[model samples]
Structures are given as C-alpha cells and as structure tokens.
Target chain A: MSTAAATHDDHHDHHHAPTGLKRWLFSTNHKDIGTLYLWFSFAMFLAGGFMAMVIRAELLEPGMQFVDPEFFNQMTTVHGLIMVFGAVMPATVGLANWMIPLMIGAPDMALPRMNNWSFWILPFAFAILIGSVIMSAFGDGNPSAPNFGWTFYAPLSTKYGPDSTDLFILSVHMMGISSIMGAINVVVTVFNMRAPGMTLMKMPLFVWTWLITAFLLIAVIPVLAGAVTMMLTDRHFGTSFFDAAGGGDPVLFQHVFWFFGHPEVYIMILPSFGIVSAIIPAFARKPLFGYASMVYATASIALLSFVVWAHHMFTVGMPLAGTLFFMYMTMLISVPTGVKVFNWVATMWRGSMSFELPMKWAIAFVVLFTCGGLSGLMLAITPVDFQYHDTYFVVAHFHYVLVTGAIFSIFAAAYYWLPKWSGVMPNKTLGELHFWNSLISANLLFFPMHFVGLAGMPRRYADYALQFADYNFWISIGGFWFGLSQLLFLAVAVLCAMKKGEKAAAKPWDGAEGLEWEVPSPAPFHTYDTPPVVK
Target chain B: MSEKQLSVEERNKRTLKKLLIWAVAMFGFAFLMVPFYNVICDITGLNGKTSSTAATDVPEQVVADRTVTVEFITQKGDGISGEFTSETKRVKVHPGEITLVHFYASNPTSTDMITQSIPSVTPGEAARYLHKTQCFCFDQQTLAAGERKDMPMIFYLDPEIPRHINQFTLSYTIFDVTERVAGKNNSVAVN
Candidate 1:
C-alpha cells in the first residue's frame, strides 16, 4: 500500500495536467474521471433523447411515418437502456466522484485507481451495446433492434431477441460491474476517508445520500447480475429459469428484475435529493429544516424499496394478496418521499431566498418532483395501477420523477458547483433563461402523458389509436422543445468552462458553508494535498 | 491546552481504531446478505423450487398418458395460422389414466418468424392446463427465411380429463417478426 501511494505521489505532480484526448483515455484523477462520466452521460442523453424524439415522431400521427413497429420497440428499449444506464446512472456517479471528496474534505477518492478502471469500462460497455444496435441493420429477420423493451421480459428476451442479444448481455454485465465497483469506492471513501470533525451526522447531505445510494447499489446490482445471468443461460444454455416449456416462470423474471430495478430508481434519485437539500438551504438562507428527519426519511424510502418490487408487475396476474401487499408497500414509500418534499419547502418557506440558476433549478425540482411523487402515489394503488400499468401514465410518472426530479437536481448541482469548478459563474441571464425553458418544457413534455396514459394508451408502442394521436402530437412538440432547450445548457456550460463568464468568489453563494467553499475558486488541479478539518 | 484535550498522536490512534472497526463491521454486514437472502427465499417459497416438484408428484405413467394442448397467436392481430399442428405425437392412455401432454410449434416462413405468442400449458383442468412453470409460454423463436423449426412444450392432463372428454385440440398461430427502431435509421433487426 505504501509503495502504491508513493508511486501515485511521484506521478501525480508531473502528469502534464493530462492534455487533450489522452487525458480522457488514460486519466486517473477523480475529477478527470468525473468529467469523463459527465461528458459520456451527456452524450448518451443526446443519443437517448434522439431515440425519444423518434418515438414521439412515430406516435405524432396515428400511422407510423418514420419507423416500423419492431424498430419502434428497439427505440424504446435502447432509449431506456441508455437513459437509465448511460445517462442517469453515470451522471449521478460523476456528481458523486466530483462532490463526495470535496464535501468530505478528502484529498481524493479513497480508491483512485479503481475509479479509473470503473470509468474506462463504461466506454467499452457502451461500445458493445451500440455495436449490437448497428449489427441488427444487416440481419435478415426484422431489420429492427431488440424490441423486448429494456426490461427484456423472458420468452421475449429468450425466444424473440436479436442475434446480438449475447452482446447486449455482455454489455449489461460490464456496466453492472462498473457500477458495483464505483459504488464500493464511494462507500469506502465516505466511511473511511472523512477529514477530522466530519462525523457521519456532521457530513454533508450529499455525502450521506451517496453513502446510502452506494449501499443500495451494492445490494441491488448483484440481483441485476443474477437476473441477466438467468437471461443469458435461458437464451444460450437452455435453462428453464424463464422457460415455461421446461417448467420455468416468465413472471419470476419480473420479480427478480424489478427487485433490482425499483431500488435502482431510488439510486438515481436519492443523490438528487441530497443535492436539492444542499442547494435549497444555501439559497433559502436557512439551515435545512428537520435534517435528521430527512435522513431517516431517506433511509425509510430505501428500506421500503425492496417490498415494492411487485408494484411493477401488478398487471402481470399477481395474486390479490400479493398485489395488495405491494400497493401498501409502494404507498408507504410516499410518506418518506413526502417528508423530503415538505422539508425542502419548509426550508425555503419565507426565507431570503434568491433565484440563482442553481436555486431556480432546485425550486423547480421541489414543485416538479412533488408532482412526480403524487403520480407515483396514484400508481401505488393496486386498482389504480390496473388502469395505469404499461400506459403512457407509467411513462409520464417515471419521466417526471427521473427527468424533473433526478435530472433537474443534477443540473442544479452542476450550476451550484460550476463556479467552484471553473472559476467563473455561468452566465446568469442565459442560465435563468435555460432554467425557465427547461422547467416549463419539461412539465409540458411529461405532464400530459398522465392523461394519455389514463385515456388508455399503452406505452412502448410505435403507433397509437386515433384518440391518442392528439396528445402524442403535443407530447412530441414538448419533447422537441425540451431537446432544444438542452442546447442552451450546453452553451452556458461551455462558455463558463472557457472563462467567458463573470469571475466568481471562492464562496459565490452567500449562505454557502462547507470545506469546499473554504478552498480557492476553480479548485486546484489537486486539492487538499493535506486534508482540512471540518467543523 | 485543557486537561480534556488529547495529544495529536492519541487523536490519530483513536481515528485509526474507529476506521478499523467500521471496516470490520461493513465486511461483516456484507457477508450476512447471502444467508439473509436465502432465509427470505426459504420463507417465501421462492428458493428456486421447481413448481412441479413443490406440488403433489404426478406418476410418470399418468404424465405419459395425458395429452397437452398448444395454441399460437399472431403479432399483427391476425389470430391463428392455417391448421397449425401440435408438434407432439398423441399419447395412448388406459381408462382413468391421468398423463402429461407435450406440444411444440414449427415456423415455416420465407422470412425468420417468431410465433406470435403462446399461452402456457399446465396440469389438470379440462379446457385449460394448470401451469407449474414460473413463466408464460415458450421462448420466442427466430427462424431464418425458409427455415423449418420445432419448439417443444410439455404439459399433463388430470385423470378427470378422460371422464369429461376423450380428445383435445391444440392450435398455433404465426406472425411476421418485427424489428426495433431507435432514433431515425438506428434500428436492430430482430432475428
């Protein structure tokens, strides 16, 4: 260990600050790894967004103009894969890598070498996935991609999957491995490497949330590994895990997958909760209300996640007792989630709140996330789920939680910390403009999906009935606007990175407090060569 | 310094002890998850128990005498295909013999075709079979153009089936396999 540390020190100073392409390829710094994650996530976001637009365009009119049914299925599947794995997860990990050490006053990630390995594995995983999609173009059968949806239900996954399903399986395995490693590093770092005075309770909410999220990741990723492994064996090794012909149950796959998947949804959003908690207080000029309750609430939500897996399979013919159990369990999640929302609002209530870009995004998150939460509650009822299952309603519910709830919080965190990272405050006018457009357009995009879903339109279909055509058209319009609005975000970020914006103070936000704020603006290439004591 | 103040070395030592304890605790916690999962599975009866084995064991002779039904549906909503034959041969049964029936599907399409979909076949019941498998119907098949394929399905009829009826009819439907589209031309052709 000492030799490894010595080698790290020797190379750390002289590493040319890693210039151009090679920096991203062979970098070992936590910040560089974070940057890689962020950039890759953004690229995947665009790719996934593009697929969504195609889906919307096809659904724009009753008839499919742009794509065929099989292709539409592929779009939905890949879009989901990219967004969940490629966009949201990577973005959250990036934020963790960048913020966790700084917030805890650590020099760097506890396992920097492992961090590099985790990031490096992602490109390869995505390459295989993207390559599989490309391979389908030459195949003779459907000329479409894996349309079984991202859940890749058995029978469909096993019997109907593309020839490249093997590749997809391998890709998912690699990504899962990367996530587990990244999560382990986070757990070790937060628990082992905190500076003096930074007790678990005293640690920043972001660190706490990440610690919890890491635990959830470690617990659930292996289940995903198990589920996909079943898929692989069923497909190749003729296993009966999901094969009814051989006495296997297809719905069991749903049980195992969602067991991993439900927590995964929390894993994506929980850190956002931490980010919003941190930002809301700083802007509101108040100490966060019910801080300990907020922690307990987060724990409650994570604990409840395991019991709610069957909620996703409600329509798949679950027994009445099982359905009722899942419904109550899912509803219980809302109590903690509601506590979080109420705390955010209470923290902001009647304080000297200022609407900076980060604050704007945070405020929007509170309102929008609540709306998402309400829809989640609606879906929690077994009877209501019967009406909403597999409909645009489910789509609307998750997009609200994920896009506005999780992704928006990420935007807020990026803006909140941008000055510290780049030495320049992002252009305020453009930032605010981007915020309002995104907030409004995002709502416009996902809010109506509830109605479309309720009106009895199934999700993941290429074409819909004439009744759904109007709503889908409007949704498409909103989606396009939302996609365009992201360009503004990119512009602002690039401008700030190039130092074309206002210079910022080390502590740009007045109410900001933390070891991170005590450091110089734009933080040095290497920060806290000696760890700082936290109070 | 106050009497309560600790020396820097002492503080460092305390921190190290705390960290070591945390590491050990975490490792112990992680180590317990597997056993904990197994316990939960055992309680829930989800410990990968083969559904058939969990139920009363049907005699192999009875399983052999039973006739299984297979139905196929189309993806384009075209319903069943032309006079689809059950892939399994008929079983001979004595009076009052309960036996498992097996069936399968063959796709004869110029293009690679997946059976639209099939419903599950289980044991017992007259019109429908009780499903002991954890999943629904057969795996989707991707047959190449002009390829002949056979997909096998297994099931059993209760002894009561003979009292209620003498013969069973099995049906199947075929559908043109579809492709998955991502963005514009970004598509994955299903095999």
Candidate 2:
C-alpha cells in the first residue's frame, strides 16, 4: 500500500476491499486477518463443544452409552487441545488484531504480511490435529491422535503410545510456530508502531494486556515446542528422554512440560484481565481505580508463573523442599490476582454504572473468576492437593476460569466491538438471552463436579460409581444446555454482520473512551492512513 | 523524508530483524533443554542416579540415634525376559552405618543378554545421602542363556538423611540392552 493509494482509498470503499475469496486469501489487512481468526476460533469452539457433549452424555448415567472408553478418552483429549490452541488463544489474538492498532492509533500492524501468515497457518495446523483424530478412529494401523490428555503426560505419550503421536507432535509444532509469529507481530506493533503521544502507560488496557500476553507466548510456546520434540524423539528414535528403562526419568518430562504449561494457563487468562479492565471501566464511567497497580500485578503474575509450575505435580512425589517452595510461591500469585480483582470492583464502586450486554458478561466474569481463583488457591496447598489431584474438582476449577473467565471475556469483547466492525448494534435481546442461558446452565454443569470430585469421582474416567450418578446426570444436562446457548451468540453475530439492526454512530456506548471510539462505526477499509496523534 | 524519519525507519527495521532472529533462537533453545536437563541432574543429582564409589577419607562409622529403613525393590523391563529378585525386601539401619544387600538375576530366555539395572531412591532427597562403595549398577551385567548370578551393594546412609522420614525405598528396574547396544553405543550420554 503506497502513500498515493492509501490517500485515494482511506475513505473510499469502492477503491479497496477486493471482492470475493481473494479478499481473504490474498489479504494483507489486519482487520481481515482478525475477522478470519475470530470465525475460525468460533468454528473450533463448536467442534470442541460437540466433543464435550459426547463426554457429558456418556457420564450422565454412570455407564458408557454414547461412546466406548477409547473414544471417550479421545473426546476429552481432543476437546481440550482444540479449545486451548484453536479456540481461546486464537480468539484473543483476533481481538488484539482488530483493536490494538486502533487503540494505539497506528495505521496498521507493523508487519502485515506476517500477520496474514500467522492467521492462515492456523487452518492447516488445526486440520492436521483434527484430521489425525479422525485417522486414529478409522485407520487400519494404531490410532494417531493424542489421547493422553491435553497435558499428554509421558509413558502414555511416549514408550507405549500409538502410531499417530507423530502427527500430534507435528501439529503442535505448527501451532507453536503460528503462536510465536502472532506474538512477535503483537509485540513489535505495540513497541514500534504506536502513534505519537500514545505512551506505554497511556495505551488502553487491552493493548497492555496483549503486550504482556505476547511476551508470555514468545517465552513459553517455544518451550512447548521443545517438549513435544523430545516426546517425538523418545517415541520414534532410540533416544530415551522419558524412558526409565533407558536411564531416562518420566518425572523429568513433567518438570519440562509444566515449565511451559504453567505460563500457558496464564497466556489464556491474562488477556481477560485486560478485557474486563476495559469493559468494566467504560460501563462504570470511571477511570480504572488502580491502573498502575493492575499493570504491575499482571507483570508479577507473569514472572511468578515460571516458578509455580511444580504445583501441578504435587502428586508426582516431588522433593519436600521443591514442594514447599512451589506451594508458597503459587499462593503468592493470589496477591497480584487479588489486586486485579479488587481494582475491577473498585472501578465500579459508587460509580454511575450501566449494564450493557458486554457489561453483563464482564460482571459475571469478576464473580466467577474469583470463585475459580479460590479453588486454585485450595489446589496450591501441597497436602490437600493429593486428594484433589485428577478429580472432578480440578476439572471444575479450570473450566470455571477457562470457560467462565477467559471465554466469557471473549464473548464480552465480541459484543462490545461487533458494532464497530459491522456498523450495526447487536440485537440486545439475543445477547442477553445468550448471557443468562450460558450463565445458569454453566454453573449447573460445573458446580456439582466439585462435590463429586471431592467425593472421589476421578476425572478422565468413562464411567462413574452409582453413588455419583445423580450429580453426573445433572452436570450432563447443564453441559448440553450451555452448549446450546452459544447458538444465540452465533445468531447475534451473523445478524449484526448482515446489518439487521439500527445503524451505529461513531461512538455507541455513552461512557466509552479511547482511540477505538474515535473511529467511525464499521471502521473504514483503511484507517489512520497517517497515524492519528493519541493526545 | 527528513533524517529523523529515515532513522525511525532504520530503527524499526533493525528491531523487527532482531525479533525474527530471536524467534529462531528460541526454537533452538527448546532442543537445548534435553541436554540442559542432564546438566542440572549432574549438578544437583536430582534424578537420584547414585554414584557407586566410596569416600576417600573413610571416617569412623558411628551409628546414629535414629534409623532410616531401606527397602529393596525390583522390576524387569517389558522388552526383557529375566527373573530379577532382591534377596531381602527391607532392612532397618541407623543412619551413618554401612549395610550390604544382594540381588539375584537369571536369564530365563534362550538368547544371551546384556542387562543394565537403573536404580532410584524414593523420598528423592534421600538419594543424595545414600552412598555406595561397591554396587553392580557401576557396570552392566552380561549373562548367557540359563546363567544366574548374585549381585551386591555395599553402602551407608549419611546422617544428613532428613528427620521427617524413617523409611525410604531403593528400586532397580532392569532393561535388556543386548539389541539396544548392538543397535548403537546405547549408553545414556549423561554426565
């Protein structure tokens, strides 16, 4: 895009947005790639959600009816892998793609070609991952897809693993490469391309959170790449990285995997911290109560993440000193996390607040995420973890944070920004219906798992004891209803994109602030052809 | 464009190049962790790979006031056919006193085999304190078909074995490395 072309096309739709499939296939625009990332993630969510339904259905009556034990394992494993890599992380990146340049007043991302490459690579990565699952189910040879849980712990992943593990390893490498590229784009755009006067501290919270999340992605994704690579060699080559018979230790695998795994959990959620930080303040009509503290808190959480990974392995018989060190360090994370939670409520305290669809999701996030955090704190205590480990309680704790916390924040962001992208208001009734339907049913689904988990209903089991049948049945019903509620979200998005509602003005929310609000609704094909001064 | 604008372009280009290079370097760093883990194990002895050498000083052995129970455990690798058993299951010894243990191994299969026994000390911190003067683990054992042998471990637990534990398990898993050795030099290139 040249200066002359940019000038000609900045406000003229006729001169840009190349028609048909070429618009997506050959596009260099950040907005287009962002849109692609969002739709792709939504599709992955539906696919993964279907797998969750199969799992819940099989568990409903304590005897496996819908799927056999093997397929059940596949369902849980692929569902987690797809949701984390394909759904949650990509959606966050999608939002960053659309909003960061606008929030920072940059003309576009620093490297547009690489942005397109990152977005396009996701389809092939997911294809191989999902396709391997299909191949595993039907292939004449040993199954290929990863069934060793999303954690893919060794022995199951290595020495005794199936033929398809090699493909899983390759898919993970592709995903890692895509993530690292996406992170590089975000970091470079934030640092080098911010418009004049948009100081690091002055940029919007979403931008700040993405900035830190990008750093985290760069740091951990490569470590994961290393981990899977070792797994690959151990399985295919004679190298005994995780083979005990070969003088290699299996627990060594856990130490390396969780090193990446811990930061990875944060990589999923920290952006939600940024998202709620943006939505709560806007709806509250107040400057964030502790913006500085929130930034530092996020940084502290990121730094502490590297040290607390061993908390996940308490049941693996870690040395006592290692156990105590990780336990206390993991608890220390609560302090910074508490700061973030308090700042959100403080921003809303006594303020003239209005609840929009986005605000509703954000509010739900604050309460639900705190509940998740408390359970996480419980898990961090070394002695108690022996009981909770691999139980439904652990499952409930993560889904509460991951589903209700991270995914809900993504829902809020989509609602908040859908009008800007499509130049029309999301149908309010459908939005609210989606929120309440999801909220009530998701609680019903996840909350009972805690009780049964404490009662010793081990997670990853295809069947439960007869004593646990009632809770499992209720939980399954909740899962189906929660899965159905998402169709409302899909409808709201498609209709808004089709321009079914009232046309939006440049600014939709009355209390909104930031460079994003300064742009026209249905942000033009090109914006900030020359950077807008942030001041 | 002015000189300042040119410099901004130069700076952005340099930083972008640096980041791309860093991404490649990070990928390399992932492969590095394989060797890196072994380095840490060498330094900290975290994996509990006990060294079977006696201390030069040979200080007078004084039995501690408390005892740390040592349990002998054994397992045969799936790919190997052998009857591996420990002569004794458990021994109670005061810390700082020497103890001797024996293990029996017989090649029940028709083929000759080279067997390597990998040892681990549980309550892992105990690994550092359990010292060996002579143990079969120092060398791999080669047994012909129908051959049997007795192996010995001479060792003492250091007084430093922490107070919280009264018992620890030392287990050895045996792997038949005949084919693996012929396949390659098969020794774990660990430090």
Best by TM-score: 2
Clashes of each: 32, 1
Candidate 1, lDDT over the whole model: 0.74
**lDDT, candidate 2, A1-535, per-residue tens:** 2443354355455656677998998777888888999999999999999989989989989776877787788889999999999999999999999999889987777778888989888999889888977886676324656778999999898976667678788989998989998998898889877877889999888898889999888888888988898898777667787887666778788888898899999999999999999999889999998888999999999999999999999987766777899999999999999999999999999989999999999999999999999999999999999999999999999999999999999999999889899999999999989999999999999999899999998999899899998899899999999999999999998998799998998889988888988889999867777677666
- List per-prediction Cα lDDT, in the order shown: 0.74, 0.86
Supply DockQ values for each candidate: 0.06, 0.44
Question: All candidates' TM-scores?
Answer: 0.78, 0.95
Candidate 1: tens digits of C-alpha lDDT, residues B3-105: 2375433443454455445434533443344345434433443322212322244534454454434332222223223234443455554423443443333
Candidate 1, residues A186-248, lDDT tens digits: the string is: 887776667777899988888889889988887788778777777887676645566543444
Error of 1 at A160 (Å): 0.7
